[model samples]
Target: MAFIFESDLKAFLFCLLQFVIAIVVSYSFSNYTNPEQRKLEKVAMLELKVEQTEKDIEQLRDLTRSLEGKYQNIESVHVPLVAFHVYNPLHTNLEVGQVIVYQTVPLNEGNGYDRKTGIFTTPVTGLYQFSAHICNQDNAMFVYAIVLEGETIALSTQRDMPSSCNTVNALTVASAGQQVSVQGVHMSKSYQVIENPHRKNSFNGVLLHRT
Candidate 1:
């Protein structure tokens, strides 16, 4: 009976050793495979984050370019544009309803005034102020008008006097390529001379505001 009891105790010891070995192998395999799987999942998450960041950066660049283009367009359209002043130093004769061609320019800011043609062409759509001063050398009645786009806008009539002067001023809006000039008319049936040796006979224009 003792020998049988010893044999039963030895069989119990063998079974306990087998159970311990199986538990250790299972723990070791689980530890190695779990970390590798976690690393693969982390790498995939990082790749997705990087792709999303790249797309965000590209969208920002496109938005910046669009804003810059709009800013440039605004800058180009609203700048201050046209101004001119011209005078005639020599004495000149004029017939009735004739355009006075002022042949000298002292201040032509935008080069819109033509000294040869005696015309100011507007460079942009804006309100402008134009002024003309005329001095009659011959003691006779004369009338002068500020001509804008082939129509009179302002007129000044001087009575018969020695060295009489008349000034006409007009404030009007003009479009691009519109013309402005000064026209003179003699009340009598004779020509009139403008004596302006001191550069008194003058025409001036300036841009007031853009439309």
Candidate 2:
């Protein structure tokens, strides 16, 4: 009886060991032989990533195309607004009320602002480039380049020391009309007409340019 019980116990232990071994072997074999499953999963992940990349590339292409169209449109128009005023020799001492026309005027009264001498208001919307020169008047004479958009100062320069009489100083403005002016004491004693008398005072309007 003792021998039979011992034999039974031995058989049971052996069976349990075999079952554990079989389970381990089956699990290992399943992982090894089915590498294709893992490969398929990797391929699916790669395909998904590639699809996302393609979508991103498409979006970038669209942005580039849109920018190109705008760039072309900008390239077409290229007009610049140019403005120049002649220095006045008689401007030895410009008084408070002394007024001068810097550009040509139509039948209408030109819109010129006298915040200071050598300055004018823009009557129309357009690019307004400004320039000026002074002569005879030494360091004592000065030309102030005060360019304004509405009441905003876009550019300002004071030519306290100028070399030539016909020297040129300038500024540019946008829109049909705006206000621009210079600040300086002119040689009120004497003045000369600019070569282009039409654009002498505040008569000439600047041309609009596409940037």
Candidate 3:
């Protein structure tokens, strides 16, 4: 009976060893069959990302070129101002007291659009104020505005503002080396004196200081 019990215990031990060995072999085989598959997937994903980045870079380059072209066009641009035949005596469009018709510099001496003459060429670059004023003997003078480019009316305004004995209207023009003119039938009187020609409205409208 003792021999039989020893034999049974040895068989059981042997069976347990076989089971563990089988499990280990199965696990190792599974890993070895597809060892490099995960690495290959990672490589493919990296390649896709790199391709997308290249496309993005190409698109950005195109956009940059387009913007550069537009900037070049803007740099070459020149804003044209309207001109009239001041020498023509038959020009009925000339109004009384219009400075463009007579004044050397048609720009207002007050830094305002008070002086509406022909186009005044810009001497320097920056912000410029334009203003106009009108007074009627009947106390019902209406003020109008038309901004022109050469012969084209870029803007016009019929908005009548209240006026004193000498009504005034004004606007600002940006940049330099452009032309400006009055676009109405009525005329305006210029200021008597200018203080600082360099500074806007420093004395009035005269650009006296060297830019």
- Indicate which candidate wins on TM-score: 1
Q: Give the TM-score of candidate 2.
A: 0.35
Cα error, candidate 3, residue 58 (Å): 3.5
Model 2 lDDT-worst window of ten: 192-201
Output the worst ten-in-a-row residue range by lDDT, candidate 3.
Answer: 83-92
Candidate 2 positional error at 7, Å: 4.6
- Pairwise TM-score winner, candidates 2 and 3: 2
lDDT digits (tens) for residues 1-211 of candidate 2: 9999999999999999999999999999998978988899999999999999999999999999999999988765645334333332223344533443333223223434332343555555555555444333334433333345434332222233432344344546445444554434333223322233322333233444544
TM-score of each: 0.76, 0.35, 0.30
Each candidate's number of clashing pairs is 0, 45, 19
- Give per-residue CA lDDT, model 3, range 51-109, as digits (tens): 99999999999999999999978765533332222221112233432333323233333
In the range 1-211, model 1's lDDT, one tens digit per residue, is: 9999999999999899999999999999999999999999999999999999999999999999999999988876675857777777233656666777877787888888887778889888888999998876566677888988879999988765666777788999999899998887555525455654552788899998777
The window of 10 residues in a row where model 1 has the poorest summed lDDT is: 188-197
Give lDDT per model, in order.
0.81, 0.49, 0.43
Model 2 regions lying over 4 Å from their true place: 80-211
**Who wins the lDDT comparison?**
1
Positional deviation of residue 195's Cα in model 2 after best superposition, in angstroms: 19
Candidate 1 Cα outliers beyond 4 Å, as residue runs: 1-24, 27-31, 51-77, 89-91, 185-191
